[model samples]
Target: MSTIERKTVVLTGASGGIGMATAKALTERGFEVIAVVRDPSRVRDVGAVFQADLANLADVVRVGRELAEKVPRIDVLINNAGLHAFSQRTTVDGLPVMVAVNHVAPFLLTHALLPKLRASRGRIVHVASDAHRRVTTLSLPDDLVRTAQFSARESSFLYAQSKLLGVLFTKALARRLNGTGVVANSCCPGLNVTGLGRESRTFAALAKVLAAVGAFSPASGARIVVRLAADPESGSTSGTHFSRDGSVKVDTTLVANVALQEQLWAETARLPAVSSLGDFR
Candidate 1:
């Protein structure tokens, strides 16, 4: 039997929970791991660690450039960084915090690294969630970037909308990269007990309680992500959304809108920082 050589993977959101666990799991399998995090001090071990706050487009550009300069090729790129805000917030770029962090940043980073990924015939894994089913609409109003007063219900709804965008983006990206020897797919990690809910004490408590009952461990939740990144079976699968167990999952109706996906791709490309990167597709 021939032993397959492990490949290099670039993973974001590595300072905590699912991302942290996934980093360790990939390392254990002998893959070269380039873990990206907001806080460099928080990462304990990895092949390499890069720091950048995903909410900032400039920071995303900086991190992308830095990675491009240092790493010659990337076999896999995992877009795992995310934020669940209980209230509305805006970034320095004036975009809604959750949308910027969960979608735009990942979009920019992935596009910026596409050349290297293409060179290696890499795969891109986007971590999505079932919560996206709750998003009934996809609207990017003129003032959508502004932070507005939000009820608890509205906050969750908006968060789901962001995840839905992720699913749509993954599909669109896969199509754009077709026949390039690169594949992109999205997956839901399920309800894992992660610090993602750190903003709410109640949520944190509930996560801890559920984790105690074996609802899901960060390690277990990270399996699909690791599998997609390393498993040979997934090499040819692109534009599909998957569940925790590696089964196919359909995106919500709102997310399945191809027109909306193209609109988002064009609008995202219009962003000053994103535009500066030149033609990514």
Candidate 2:
């Protein structure tokens, strides 16, 4: 089968695991892979790499402007950078670390790149997770940002909620990009033993056990994202969620209420991190 030529893809979280695997896979397949990462020294052999810490909103803006100036167009944007913090932490902008890293940073980056993406008729792939289903409620209280108390269990729940917000953000962005050539979709990569949890020793051991038991490898986990970015058929699919196998998947509660999604979008927009982006359509 013939493949697309000169395709450009910007992927966050490329320092390791699924992100690193995806960067290699895409580059080997003839796509120009731009690896967005925080530590440049850790990345090796990626086609092109940029360093930016997504936890900082100012860095997000600076990186966005720098990327826009450097790249003429972006054929695909993969919002794969994420954090699974086991404690409460805040960014320089004062937003929760999980929320900032997982959602707001990608939101700002994608918004800043929209014009370039539209010019290339690009696709957006958000590496969300089925863990979103674990979030008991979508409402984030005003004090949620202020409270610093957190346990590992509570942090897991918050991380899941951040992923849920990613799903909603994808939906809202798709609607906003309607009539443009850009398409947006989110997906769950299934359980993967990709060393994504190296931050905690317990998680690292669990990741190893999961790998032994047949949880997908990082390469397998990245397949859906690669497919969404490079497969011609995916050009027509937008505003939907998918599983690792590329099948449509949705949380029933999330799909049932467009109003909730919109409200979430508005609320997220009001977040200081996102609001500071300055008129992102």
Candidate 3:
């Protein structure tokens, strides 16, 4: 089974619960796996690790370029890396850390590798969350660059907003690749206890307690992402959103709004990180 030739999957957050699970599952299914993580030492047994801090746009952009140059072909790019900061912190680029890691970094990385992906007619799976349902509205220009401070209690709403941005990005990207073979979609992993906000010893204890309770395991969350990345049938479906179950269709309140989606695309494109790569319409 050495060097079995299936497509390759570029998975972010591969060291985390769902990422590790997805990397193993994809490997077993014969896809070559390349993991992009913040700390390479933290991940092993996952094929080829490329380290980059998603919270740092410069680091993310540089890694995106390196991956495109190094990986001959990319069949699927899963933007699974994300965090829930109990308290607000901002990146050097001035975007909220969560937004930087979860949404902006992926947006930039996906575009950077668009050529290889386009050549391979690949699929892009965004690891979004159902928490997007909590936000009733989103303002693109303001939200993308907001530097205001918020308490831990206010962080969940911000996290939800970022995921909703992912949904918008998926739909908009799918539209952009309308005739191209490349496809894009997003999914909610459902109450994943694997990643509860970072830097909290309290949440760490809660995670172990939840682990003992046998709820929302990371392996379980990785299933839909695996299906979306590996299933030939799923390759044909783009711009569709999936629920935690992977069977039910999630509501597309903001996701289905073409106008909003395009606006997000335009605004995201306007960001310095994205614009530095290339002009994306």
Candidate 4:
């Protein structure tokens, strides 16, 4: 008789939407789901939950270290937590709330757990969005941590820029993980009716209406993430941006701009909140 090995996945933002759905799907497929959330009680029954307030970068580091010390091996890491702020906000780390939650925190967590991921030769999937191109222009370094001063009217564009950073981060990470057997990729969840907009009642209502019409369900949006995390075919694939239909797509200029990616990656590492991550090598 042969014994089967159980795959373990560490996921962020499993309290709702694509993250929650992906957790369930992975669980059904016999993978152990470890969720990093703000409230463990909310997801206690779903899988293992580690409490962390992603808005606070220090907390992210604490939680990441905890996971690194505890989990023996991690087969996959899904950076699924995200936030689209209606107004400019800052986290305890003094970085823009959107940038902190959507990008920086994930960067920190992934680095903290790199050793475990390397041991398992794991995969990393970032829940990005086609909205990256919507930013029009990216003024790297500055915009990566500083949210442009804006009103609610311009909030969507800010959110787009954050997701764009995720794409760039994945591209840079893939290069770094080259010989380590760890692959990195980003995916667009389409327009799912997730609670990402609960801060605005009007937007929330609109999302509900659109969801009822044709927006992908949370479960539907999670499929690509699950595939990227668990499918053997995706193991060899890295540094690619995947769309809702599993097609590779990101602005040509963005992917070709290796200088931009490198600059961004270097600056991200030096961020006050993440500077201490050291080389997880």
lDDT values for all models: 0.86, 0.83, 0.86, 0.86
lDDT of each residue in 42-89, candidate 1, tens digit only: 997888899999988889988998998898678999999999999888
Model 2 spans with C-alpha error above 4 angstroms? 1-4, 140-146, 209-215
- Rank the candidate models, highest TM-score first: 3, 4, 1, 2
Clashes of each: 0, 0, 0, 0
Tens-digit lDDT track for model 4 on 135-205?
Answer: 65777678966755788778888998898888888999999999999999999988888999888888899
| TM-score of candidate 4 against the unseen true structure | 0.94
Candidate 1 similarity to native, TM-score = 0.93
Q: Whole-model lDDT for model 2 versus the true structure?
A: 0.83
> Candidate 1: what lDDT?
0.86
- Alpha-carbon TM-score of each model against the true structure: 0.93, 0.92, 0.94, 0.94
lDDT preference between candidates 3 and 4, better one: 4
Model 4: lowest-lDDT 10 consecutive positions: 272-281
Number of the predicted model whose TM-score against the real structure is largest: 3
For model 4, the superposed segments whose C-alpha errors exceed 4 Å read 1-4, 210-215, 276-281
